[model samples]
Target: MSHKPRGLRPDERELWQRVAEQSVPLHPERAHPVKQVIERLNKAPAKHRVQHFTMGQTARKIAPQHNLAPHITDHLMNNHVQMDRKAFGKLKRGKLGPEGKIDLHGMTLAQAHPRLLGFIQSAHGQGKRLVLVVTGKGKAGTGTGPIPERRGVLRHQVPHWLLSPPLGTIVMQVTPAHLKHGGDGAYYVYLRRRK
Candidate 1:
């Protein structure tokens, strides 16, 4: 059976009133802060009035803020050329054929690192000048998180790997591959002459 609502007993009601009267509010201002804010907002003069427009008028557009880092291609392009200018131009134009090539498309970071290091070392030891590293354009991520995820993991990391220890000393220039070689997915790695 459902219980019916009942009024507080006279003794209980008196006890409640006594307790309430004796107790102090921890945050008196917070009790009605929302109401205070509304009142203040109502009293303040309006700073930004809405503009009137006709039915067919286009809405004003705001320029988007660019918070993300620059593209990997831009970074590589901006880096000072370490090799010959004439050869660099030829390399960029796909004139210089890669003597050695490595495909690290589907490999994890752990797997790709050691393989990349060894490949570069071997290529340098064999007296290869230009090499091709194929790291396919990574899959798109769900743009749900606060910090945006970079598209290609290998594409971004490959440049850094070439520039860091062991490989950095031997590697002369690193550039994005031309369309025929593999657009943004591959790199043209030029190695220094063996000493």
Candidate 2:
């Protein structure tokens, strides 16, 4: 990734307290941070397990039923998502464990971005609403740190990534998860089907 890794900003340093304590790499065997998971996935030359959903079918099938107020989509499309602790939850192991769960534990930002879009497309197509993405809060904080804070990376950057480029047009809104589902660490990503 070309993004510069600088020291964490004051705000990020604060965020580090919450994030660093929670996140863990998805693959224990790999021994790397979760943010690097995506890059490794791209280079592994083994398998692409993350499911992909198409844009067209999702637009035609899912968008019509979300009951999204006409203007809400537009507003979300053009606005910045203001994250608040009021909207997040920790995932219950029963509800979010395995089967249909998408494990983002070790995925890199680049790998996670496309897969997240496809996931939204697929879920939207299947007439599903209110999908959950489990982005860890982060594992490194201020003290005893080898990597500088900015490498704290995905902890704060994922939100911007969601609002940029190809994914941005497909998504209408994104908010921090509710308290029952890994709040602040996860996101409630709302997708918009094309008109």
Candidate 3:
């Protein structure tokens, strides 16, 4: 049940009236903060306005076709891998233990890129065939911001780096790690036997 507000006593009402009569408005001429802010914003010319693009439009602009042959390029144009039936079987079966492994967590692009190249080169030098590269499935971005945040930059970029020259020539194949290994956040890098 809703309760009504109690009526003020006669003495209380008189006291309230006296106080109200004595009290003058403080800063009655003051402009509202929100209004002032709106006025300032109206006066300023906005430099950057939001631009919307469809998926196809964005893909056309951001993703250009590569001149490289399909065989040399990974499915994502990131890494190159050619695996025969037996090699594919071995990798998928998780029969081969990673001779080397590198975790690329909490590292920025600048730090991760060079370290990745170095790790791969070193593993290749050691004649290691199967190695693991871990890139955590990045956190989902907060959707409120103007610019969209991309998740799993390394997950996408690592494949590209693996397919690029110098390392590409050495990297024989790359496959997504099995669930036992690291699932989506990791890769199984199979290197060519040292010549």
Task: Estimate the TM-score of every prediction.
Answer: 0.67, 0.42, 0.57
Task: Give the per-residue Cα lDDT of candidate 2 at 121.
Answer: 67
lDDT of 3 by residue, 1-195 (tens): 999999999999999999999997888799889999999999998889779866676454553333344422245324333767677777877877899999998888899999999999999989898899998777766646656555577876787788788789998788888888987788889898899
lDDT of 1 by residue, 7-97 (tens): 8999999999999999999988675878989999999998997799788478777644443788999999999999999999999999989
lDDT (10s digit) by residue, model 2, range 119-158: 7667767655356777777675454444334423454566
Identify the runs in model 3 with alpha carbons over 4 angstroms from their true place. Answer: 1-81, 145-148
Candidate closest to the true structure, highest lDDT:
1
TM-score ranking from best to worst? Answer: 1, 3, 2
- Cα error of candidate 1 at position 81, Å: 0.9
Distance from true location, Cα of 160 in model 3, Å: 0.9
Each candidate's lDDT (Cα)?
Answer: 0.93, 0.58, 0.80
